[model samples]
Target: MTEIWNILFNPLPNAIMTLLTGMSLVYWLFTMLLGDGFEMGTDADIQFEGADVQDVDMDADTQADLETEQHVEPSFFSKAMDFIYVGKAPMMVLVTLFKFISWIVTIASSLVLNLAAFGWKSVLILIPVFILSFFLLHYVAIPFVKLYKNVGYAGEEAHEFIGRLGKMRSTIQGEQLGAIEVVINLDVIRLNVKSKDGSLLSYGDDVIVTNQDPNKKFYIVQKDINLNNI
Candidate 1:
């Protein structure tokens, strides 16, 4: 137990990775508990600013097609991120996975390196360890991404939840926040939600989805009148 504790928090390198790993684990647990709709990263509508413009004159169709291609083309950073299948999985999910794996590798490598080399600081070992871990994560996350891709909203399914009936799993104070469970294509999905009105909705309360804020990835919900009458 003492050794495990030391590996997780005592050493400087282990401490930093431990915090990252713990946060990542917590995010995953929260995502599972609340529903796959809780997002802690950027939304799909990310726009790349200041892209190079083409000055060639073309027909409307050709121009439109070129614009579409440009929009679809991943930026350099996004292309690099593809090594870890960024778009194939939720950002938080990917981050959590990478951090957890990095933490484990950091601990093991630190122990081994300490034996071979004396008087080396944990910080010095961190740079190389992190770079190696990132390379390993790039490959390791592929299969996991493929596995989870079908389970969550990888594409068009992201917007399918709109207009669906949702049941509150947690209380939502008006203008505050809450969580709700809804069924889509026979899959029970949980999503972060906010009341459409400034009213309190308690757990087990049935609500109706009125809209979705893509920027925040939260649903705007309202009390179901029919269910309230029951």
Candidate 2:
């Protein structure tokens, strides 16, 4: 067992790879546990609803897949991330997967290349290892995320959610915050909502999505006046 441990991660090079791989795994575990509470993919260019506007060409084939989500420009780092997946799942999940795969490859190569004995010479092996693993995963993630999106998990896009009916999950009184649950394409999703008119709404009151925040993070909603009349 000790021998095997050393083979996977012991020497300085292996130690670095193991650390990278471990960080990725730990992060994903936290994401799974924390769910939406944790912002795992801060670097991811895409969101659950759609791609950041400027980073995406908008004409790309993947854009057709999202059909209903909002569009916005992502940060520069996120634009680089666009080369990978376009956000079928949370960007955090994709980022973690990419790191996990790359780190594993880096570790494996370090062992096989026997860079442990080379001292400073290992840098030669490490540089190319990082580049190859990074790009390799970037290209591979596109198809994988696309496939994940296709088999269900459709229609939770921002564009489609706008104008959809949702029930307030909490009370909101004038410029305060609330949550709304709406069904889009038969899928129940939730969003942070605010009233357009600063009107008060009670829990379970019906509301309509009137607009989205500039950051596209949440919805601006209004109480459905006709709901009470009906």
Candidate 3:
């Protein structure tokens, strides 16, 4: 047992093993802690800024084409392809692949170093590290990939709604107990809004979809011009 302990704890080999193990641990920890909350994926409508909403026609044929497309199940190989092809933010798959490669390299190198430095007895140290790596990869790394994907989808979805034109389905009055219903993406969303001038607006008032507050997750709207009057 003393001889086995010496082989496992030998200062020279343990130094390299510890460094690699610590690096792997830190990488997993950072992804788990921060990657989940951060957004990833492309905003489909990012380029439509400052353009008149009326000028941009929502093509029915294009919408129909998009709707008719079949959802294909991405094979493991295809997912890997996406990681390479689609280089978007919050790199979930790519980071995971890198971590996987790191683990492989770390374990292989550790094994070689251990064998050279301490022979077969070093297998004892390798066993525990291998087990630790497996648990960390499965529990920590996998969940982070899922979390980053979710955040990415949400960010992209929210971006789509920005600058969309909607009608005032209900009156938006700033008076006590006054609220407005706006049709956004054909969905009537109720909003508790105040006029920019702090005046009460009437029912069927034309309101423009303005800004969305991230912290409050609500829309900041403003009055729109009456086309009939214009």
Instruction: Extract clashing residue pairs from model 2.
Output: 52-72, 53-72, 53-73, 54-73, 69-158
Which model is ahead, 1 or 3, in terms of TM-score? Answer: 1
- lDDT score, residue 210, model 2? 80
Q: In order, what lDDT does every prediction score?
A: 0.60, 0.59, 0.43
Q: What RMSD does each model have against the real structure? A: 15.3, 13.2, 17.7
Q: Ranking by lDDT, best first?
A: 1, 2, 3
Model 1 segments beyond 4 Å from truth?
35-76, 115-120, 155-157, 160-230
Instruction: Put down candidate 2 lDDT per residue, 85-137, tens digits, no spaces.
Output: 43334455566666667667767776677777887667566678667766787
Q: For model 2, what is the error of residue 96's alpha carbon versus the real structure, in angstroms, after optimal superposition?
A: 1.9
Specify the poorest-scoring 10-residue window by lDDT in model 3: 49-58
**Candidate 2 residue runs with Cα over 4 Å from true position:** 35-79, 86-89, 120-124, 151-230
By summed lDDT, the worst window of 10 consecutive residues in model 1 runs over 48-57
Among the numbered candidates, top TM-score falls to: 1
Instruction: Enumerate clash totals for all models, in the order shown.
Output: 0, 5, 0
Quote the positional error of residue 22 for candidate 3 in Å: 61
Candidate 1 lDDT over 1-230, as tens digits, reads 99778667756777888988888777668767977654422243431111001100123664464344333343465346556665455556667777877788878877876622433366566778777877888888877665554343332144355677877656657565565666544434456677887688876788988876655446688988894557
